[model samples]
Target: MIPSFPVDVERIDPLLASEVRRHYDRGGRTISFCSGSFLLATLGLLNQRTAITHWRYAEQFKQRFPHITYRDDSLYWYDGRIGCSAGSAAAIDLGIAVIRDDFGYEYANAVARRLVLPAHRDGGQSQFVQKPLAPVNAALAKVLDRAVKHSGSGSTVEQIAAKANMTRRTLDRHFIRHFNMTPHQWLCERKLEVARQLLETTHLSVEQIAGRAGFDNAVTLRHNFNKYLSVSPTKYRQTFKSSQQPF
Candidate 1:
């Protein structure tokens, strides 16, 4: 980005790919706005890092860099050292966040209002999605996500299939075609991811987490966590959780 403060504009050309790598290696804050994420990827700064770009370009980004964990379908993603904004306008939100970090909320809000935009946002994408997908797809996603959202006490593939008015075979085929994963595999991964995020962010008891995450019991939760993460919930929390970020 053009520095907020004054710098010789003529010197911008001297900033090379190698220089960007040095900055990333030194653990400095680095960001790319929408398509600009390519600059980082082109320079190899995204190795082993999870990042996002706009949805339209996700496949191209992945095809170009198969080694990196590019999750551009999301509105945004922030790894510790690098961050990427999704759609072009999301850059404004990222800018506001940066201003808030560097200055404060007052300054960020003033800048946002002066720019004729909202002050802040709480969740992910706000814009309505363009495509018209099926309710069955959404219901399936809800059931899969429900493992974490409602703690797995609700919903299963058979239940989802019944609600979607499809047979089990049809649902299984759809899951394979769209997600390249079986229903059980997808559910397990989704549950584990939710459990990890919760463990890292909250002080919820294991029993509560199990209940909320649809693990049936703490024993099941512990078993799944160990199988996937190679660490127990308590140990994983101790190692990974430093602070929580609210949704």
Candidate 2:
């Protein structure tokens, strides 16, 4: 794992570069946090591979490594072999992903809970999210939890806001301030998380998963899965399930 470092380092020590290259050549996994991507790019490990660094360095990194596919919007990214976190906070999310991949969803979630962190955050989430000023009110939090619990019912943003006794505009403001996203986006993310958990832990069919996830249908689920994850639900299930370490 490569931690954040000065991206402006003019030259990598030859020995360190040689070691990193040797590790890659032997099919070792690689993970970089923040500007650590610079090291990976310098060695051409990121060429033609999707990568992300802190948004502050996006322009400079892209200019210097045009061959690397830089995803500015992603908070973190992983392609089985290589992984990257966009910033320090994102490093936690990526670390949890690594734990989930190595151990199992339940084990990872348990670990996250012990650390007082959210169990997961999708890798494709934007990097520009602002830190929330405070936690949501109890009513609003309860509504959000219920929405996730009954995601299959396809609750609309208006209905959810109403359940929390807030106007749509008010709810939007709260969501943006606390979650750095609109209510609809948060709802979609929650649904997607539910879908992913089911995929990882159950034998449910795609159509069934779609309904449970609050997607309009299986086709919509497939489309959203591909758009956000660059992988089909079936393929994602196979990848995670096959590689999942027994708890």
Candidate 3:
């Protein structure tokens, strides 16, 4: 069962929490969506179990329940009879999984088809999380913005630093402080995001998309896609493309 939010586990009536626990105690399969995991944790239902929740709430979950294994990178996790999902879309994925387990793959696939969703998504929450730039000084923010705008044009870190009137070392420092990543890493993620979008929305060939996304070639794009997303570009397109048209 899913709990409604604004979840205040601390303010929830003890009897209500006990009733929820009793539901689980009676062999009820529980699926917690997003912040609902907090309610389950309050009832000790998630203790020693691997769970996932919205990435934005991951830190708070960790702080509150250090004993539970919190898998922040997964869209959802199924541990025996208890399951948890990352967010709204991920909750749909978890529901599909439940259907698959209860019936079979064919039933789950049919349900997914009816919903116009993929039967399963590859990779994890990292692929869906917004990689926001760190709030930095105004000058650095402008520099980062320029880099993002030209990400598809293969702008180098040196060029970005020059635009910011800073040395390479200074640029690296600012990037670490503001983004927790080197300039190169941030640029690669930006390019990959562009490539993923193009793959989903367009029928561009891999080579064409690679050029548009600032990769050297289709091979490079494949390598990076596999490394970062754990799926090939073609496979990613197949999974997320809205239409059944041949690529």
Give the number of the best model, judged by lDDT: 2
Candidate 3: pairs in clash: none
- Give me the runs in candidate 3 sitting further than 4 Å from their true place: 1-35, 42-64, 70-134, 244-247
Model 3 per-residue lDDT tens digits across residues 102-215: 543355567999999876522322223223455788887887787778779988888888888899999999988766679988888889878876887789999999999999
Model 2 residue runs over 4 Å out of place are 3-9, 25-27, 33-38, 41-81, 84-92, 101-104, 113-116, 124-134, 242-246
Quote the lDDT for 77 in model 3. 80
**TM-score to native of every candidate shown:** 0.52, 0.70, 0.59
- Every candidate's CA RMSD: 8.5, 4.4, 8.6
Better of 2 and 3 by lDDT: 2
Q: Is candidate 1 or candidate 2 better by lDDT?
A: 2
Candidate number with the higher TM-score (1 or 2): 2
- Displacement of residue 19 (Cα, Å) in model 1 is 5.5
Best-to-worst lDDT order: 2, 3, 1
In candidate 2, what are the lDDT values of residues 1-247, reduced to their tens digit?
Answer: 9997688985899999999999999999899999999999998888878888998999999999988888765778876578888889888878887777665567778779887988664643222223335888999999988887887778889998889999999999998888878998887777788788888888899999999889999998898888776779998787666344434
Write candidate 1's Cα lDDT for 1-247 as tens digits.
Answer: 5112111122333467567767777878887877767767766677887656777667877887799886634555554356677766776767666654444335656789888986442211121111223344676666555444644454576776776677889888887777655777667766775676577667899888887777788999999887765669898777556442321
